[model samples]
Target: MNAILLILIMIAMGAIIGGATNSLAIKMLFRPYQAVYIKNWRVPFTPGLIPKRRKDMAEQMGRMVVDHLLTPEGMQEKFNERGFQKQVIQILQREAKGWMHSKRSVADLLKQYAGVTDARGKMTAYSEEWIDKKLQMFIYHNQEKSIDEMLPPEWKISAESYFDSFAARIADKGARYFESDAGRVQLETLLEKFLQGKGSVFNFLSSMFGNDKILDKLQPELVRFFRDPSSAMFFKGFIIKEWEKLLDQPVWKAGAQLNTKSVARYSVKALNRELTVLDRLDMPIAEWAPSYEEHIINKWIPELWDQVQPALSAKLLSVFDYLELEDVIRERVDTFSVGRLEAMVLAISGKEFKMITYLGALLGGFIGAFQGLFALFFS
Candidate 1:
């Protein structure tokens, strides 16, 4: 009876000590939520391991994310993937299609993108100051190229050629007018006035010939001369030369009242008029969808992406650094409450941590048993 009682007491002590040790260890991981103090002395292991190392952990995580997961090469590889590009293009098409189909006006879309809304929840027109700033940026970018140089050769030729033909047409019309009856009447009146001004010799000759007869005869010959094809051709060539001279005039010096800003403003006004027309905006995307897809895929997309790839590769790292990604991440983590941090960690590793606690209990139980066994043996 005594032996049995002693063994049972040993087993009970072992179980109790083992359970207590494991529970205490588990509590230590999160106890003291903050540092504890005894007067001027800080109690040993007051703050939990995680709380003490939180800042360092945040920094390490930021570095690991940026250096490994979000590296430039990794991002570039993802961007260059064919499937990714196609998916992105499809998403953009869907978004644009949605915008076109929606009842929203262009003003609404602009306001949404610009993040400009009034108290009434209505979108206002862009301020002149805002438009001017945008225009100035555009002007600065294109400042190195003259207007003619900026234009594609084909476009320049097409516009200039229209004026070249217009000059010839104007000249043709003027030559024809000179051969008309009204022109003959004016010429006859001028001739009569000239002869009247000349002294008596011309007047006497004109009177003998009869002024009406001389005038009638001279008028037909003058009209015939102007009606001649060669005369029309000569005038056409002269007008075309003058028009060419006008074309060569510098754009800025072409008119006393005009400057680049005024021109750009006028262009903006014209574009805004077209843009605001609800009729134009109401058209379905499907009407031009095929053409849009074709041009975008074959021409615009390739050309734009070619430029984008180089520019992105060169500046993406600098832009990421400018964004202060590491600081942003670290700050965000630091802002999280300890409770939240604990919850997050537990959420991720709760099972493992629970197993660790159970294992600690088992180990402590074996240690206690061993001690109990030694004590009993010595007794």
Candidate 2:
């Protein structure tokens, strides 16, 4: 009876020690959330394994996530998948369909999306500003350049070719003006003035010949002079000289007379009138572009996806590099409280951990049993 009681006592003690040690070991994995210090010395294993190695664990986690889970190849593969593409397309189509039936005007849409209150006014202002800026830039760039240098070679050639015709037209017009009754009257007055300017003898001759006869002769002579080729050549030379003077002047000199603000405003107005689409800004988009949905679904979405998916896949590596995803994961893990980390780990592998604890207990019990048997054998 004493031997049997001894054996029973040994077995019970072994089981209790085994179970308690195992439970304590399991608890030690996460107990005492912070390090414990006694006077000048620090207690060993006070903050637990996880808390002590949190930084290294976080780093490892980050590297593991980046290297294995969120690899560029894996992302590219997912992006290229037909399922992802189809989902994106379907989402875009649904949004487009909603927009197509919307009663909101373009201006309203602009207001909602871009915070633009007056779309037309804003566009006009922007256009005017753009025009003004461009004009200013042009003036700044060409202010020192002479018109001759600024003019295109082809334009210079064309202008030179037309000079003769221009001069001929001017001469023809001058002759016709002189042939009119008004021209005759002006000729008579000029002759009288000339006689008066001369001495009384010339005046008496002019009166004796009669002003009418003098004018008739003067008019024919004037017409003949204008018809003469030399007259046309003279006008052409005059025109060429004037043109050369103009061409020699710088662009700033030419533009000095212009009102740029007024020009920009007028240009904007003309553009607004010519672009009839601007008028549709106040009208509902559905009214103007009813086929938008069909086009978006059939053409735009597919084309956009086709272009964007490959680009995204190609850029996935660059994006991942820029994001430093591993560092992000590591930082997140580091920030997590020990208790929270423990809870999460337990949640994932709680059953396995329990089994490990039980295994440890079983092993401990086996060891205790062997020790007990050895003591008995020695006795």
Q: In candidate 2, what are the lDDT values of residues 1-379, reduced to their tens digit?
A: 7666666667767777877877787778888888899997889988888888899999999999888888999988888889998998889888887777789988998999989998988888888899988887887899999989989999999999999999999889889989999888888778777788698888788879988887878898899889999999999999999999999999898878677778999998887788656787888888867655667778988999899889889999999999989889999999999999999999998998778767766776677677777778799
10 residues in a row with least lDDT, candidate 1: 119-128
lDDT tens digits, residue span 249-348, model 1: 5444443333545655566567647764333333444443454565665566556665676677677778887888788888888777777888887889
Residue 181 CA displacement from its true place in model 2, Å: 28
Q: Runs in model 1 with CA error above 4 Å?
A: 1-20, 37-42, 112-172, 175-223, 240-303, 368-379
Tell me, by TM-score, which candidate is best: 1
Cα RMSDs, all models: 7.0, 9.1
| Per-model lDDT | 0.66, 0.86
The residue pairs that clash in candidate 2, if any, are none
Best by lDDT: 2
Error of 2 at 185 (Å): 28
